[model samples]
Target chain A: MRAKTSAALNRSELEEELRAIGRRRYHDRHPFHELLHNGQLGRGQVQAWALNRFYYQRSIPKKDAALISRADSAELRRVWRQRLADHDGDEPGHGGIARWLNLCAAVGLERRKVESLDGLLPATRFAVDAYVHFVREKSLLEAVASSLTELFAPDIIADRMRGMLAHYDFVSNEAMAYFDRRLTEAPRDVDFALEWVLERAETVEQQESVLDALRFKCDVLWAQLDALYHAYVDPGHIPPGAFAPQDESTDRPRRYR
Target chain B: MRAKTSAALNRSELEEELRAIGRRRYHDRHPFHELLHNGQLGRGQVQAWALNRFYYQRSIPKKDAALISRADSAELRRVWRQRLADHDGDEPGHGGIARWLNLCAAVGLERRKVESLDGLLPATRFAVDAYVHFVREKSLLEAVASSLTELFAPDIIADRMRGMLAHYDFVSNEAMAYFDRRLTEAPRDVDFALEWVLERAETVEQQESVLDALRFKCDVLWAQLDALYHAYVDPGHIPPGAFAPQDESTDRPRRYR
Candidate 1:
């Protein structure tokens, strides 16, 4: 367990503590990610993942906007403005959410169904919404700290893109554009967020809150997978009204059928 | 799927729609509940349920208070005030939360661990926080409608009480005082809430929102059970830091041991 002590630490020590949290609790360590990164998950299981994960993708811009709204100065908000544009784009039919939709479509989920969020797991909605609310309600330092999950995201995105390309015959390099985009975008965002959090969290209490925020954010990402693993993976009992892929019983990709 | 139509119906039709939502979507129909109410769960599994559920039990008054804070009238606030008293009591250590802690204690969990929320599943925290946020942020009618899950609560509580007492020697009637109190309290609370919803949801949009609110509330309850079932039941992969039972490998009651 991470110590809950109130004793203050040096800047480098605090940064190490934050990095340690990502090492231990990031969603990349989750079993679902393990299966997802490798070829272990079936085609329908992959579709289930894409379908539910669209909720998180869709919420990113909204959360970024909330964080921008809470930012203290034009400098912070100006730095954060790239995230909104990065996810939302300069015009319609663009950006991260749309790219995610493309990935969902590539996986054989209907475009309309994915856009409508017709069969999202309730747990996904709750977790994503909680993250947005955390940014909106918590201190600005904590809000920036929460985005520190991005510190770990680029590595996972690389692993995911590499694994999916190699393992899934149906998945093409073009279809993995979202991860490719995030690979660059995430590092840029995290660098600013990490520096801001480290510079601003000067006191023991603020530092602990920063650590807790990242831990909370990690929990948010981790819980999303736990829901997926539970509902669509082992002993799979899809909750009433969640997406239930038709080809779950088969190992083959039945996208066209 | 529940229809999202805007065509207004008569009061009875609206009431029927709301009741139908409960019939189809309430957590009672969740498989985890089926296992628990049928006396199929092991003692450690039961402890997992109680430990995670303590979060939900602990949040009721906070949600109720949020609802009360939003009430437009003394009359409405006055009616909702009983929920606060019922869950929190006239004095410390006297009401529903206290009774739930008693139930947790009787289930062989240490009091400090449960109170500290040491091993809470992130999904549980997310789902419960979503419910509370719904009450705090949504329309008053929708908030009250969310509580309409109470319309179906009595039966489940009775089933839970009987099943736990019959199947688990570690459980006793006193351990279930929480449910017994809720049995009477829920009906009275729901009567007012149901009537308020029926009387106030005068427009088609309002009625539809009310129905959606109940559906949202059911999703909250069902998602909590999904987390429990995922973590403590079949192919269980307890999330890192979540409560893990020591005797999960055995079916025998090992509370004393």
Candidate 2:
């Protein structure tokens, strides 16, 4: 029976703020996603997305592993350990990263080209690196709170899975198995993180910091799409030494071993 | 003396490589500066430049202090201590940073606004933070070598001092005093660092590291101007929550207390 006060937000109030953040700031709201989902994007554009996203996908396990290393509680470790397992899997040729590479191959990018990362946009690298560094450098609560973007993730993943499959013939059910898994994993992860954050963020200052970390994560995600839209969409201001799509056509689906 | 192979560059060759890096990569060559120095930029652009460059100027004392804290030799400390004095000065009103704030005031930006840094572009902050991190984290010779951007600085400063004053009525000989001082200070500082680096970068690996450091520092500077150019000059995409110039006209010059 808690009443909301200016001193601090009750759980529901904090939840509302977090939801409002996702509503306003999520990459799901980015025009790139709108174009991406509706099949309006070129094949080269799709390939560019797959290629750049592989960097984020590959880095997730490392980010999760960094978080796990700093976890003081076994309960926290138990919940977070699943992130590493989900991302890294038990052995080689498995897990989300491998599936992402498969998507890259399906989208017609050479697997080695994505993995080498020599063609990454500086904006992509900086935005992603800033996230990893934020998690490593900020307080544990802030680190854990940053992942609350997952609170908004299930919807984006669903939209992406549905829209990408519908719009792009090059995309297939197999290329999207990654999202199917995320649909389940994200909700569970978000629930655990949400409950953990709500319980721990008792003070108004802590609540604000938690909220700000979520907003920061949203900016990180949004900036990636902004870079993509700028480079691939209007104005096409491709910086020097980033991956250049061969031509302005949709890539045919290809299988890679 | 070691013959020039894949292995080692002799002193003069290393100097040439460092200078060559400056020739190719310095921010002086950035299109932003081309517009800035040619008087092609509007007053808003000049004001934006002053506001952002303040972040770099104020950070100098802290950067120099970080390097000094790591220096192993008394001679190094004595020379480096002068950098501290030059930026921070003996008292509050005297140093390079204070002069920079005065310039900011002269350019019609609120000095308080520049000092608060709430108006800074994300790109400016990240680039400068990366430099501070590099100096704090890298080897001493590499840290010292990174400042070797100063080796190229005197020329840029002289050109800037002449060009800015020649072009902008708001800019005067007194307002130009900081660059004048830097013209004298940079060469002396660079000569000390260059000799220290050449004499001590005894291995090819160390030499390469020093060269890479100088290159990294160049990137730091070039990236800042790229942000300014992108936001102020060309596509004019100012990021959300950065300082927005009130009007396109050059600000009427004003002096500060």
Highest DockQ against the true fold, candidate: 1
Clashing pairs in 1: none
Candidate 2 lDDT by residue in tens digits, A151-187: 8888788888889898888888998888888889999
Docking class of 1: high
Name the 10 consecutive residues with the lowest summed lDDT in model 2 chain A: A248-257
Q: Worst 10-residue stretch by lDDT in candidate 1 chain B?
A: B248-257
Residue lDDT tens for model 2, B1-257: 23345678789998988898888877788777877778887677798999899899988778889999998789899999999899888998898998898888877788777888866876666667677877888899889999999988877787888788889988888887788889889999988999999998878888888887887788778767766765676556565556777663445422110
Clashes of each: 0, 2
lDDT of 1 by residue, A1-257 (tens): 44666577888988999999999999999999999889898778898899888999899888889988887799999989999998898898799988888998888889998988888999999999999999999999998999998888888999999999999886888789998999888998888888888888888889989998999999999999988888878768787778777754574433321
| lDDT by residue for model 1 (B82-110), tens | 99999999998899999999999998999
Error of 2 at A87 (Å): 2.2
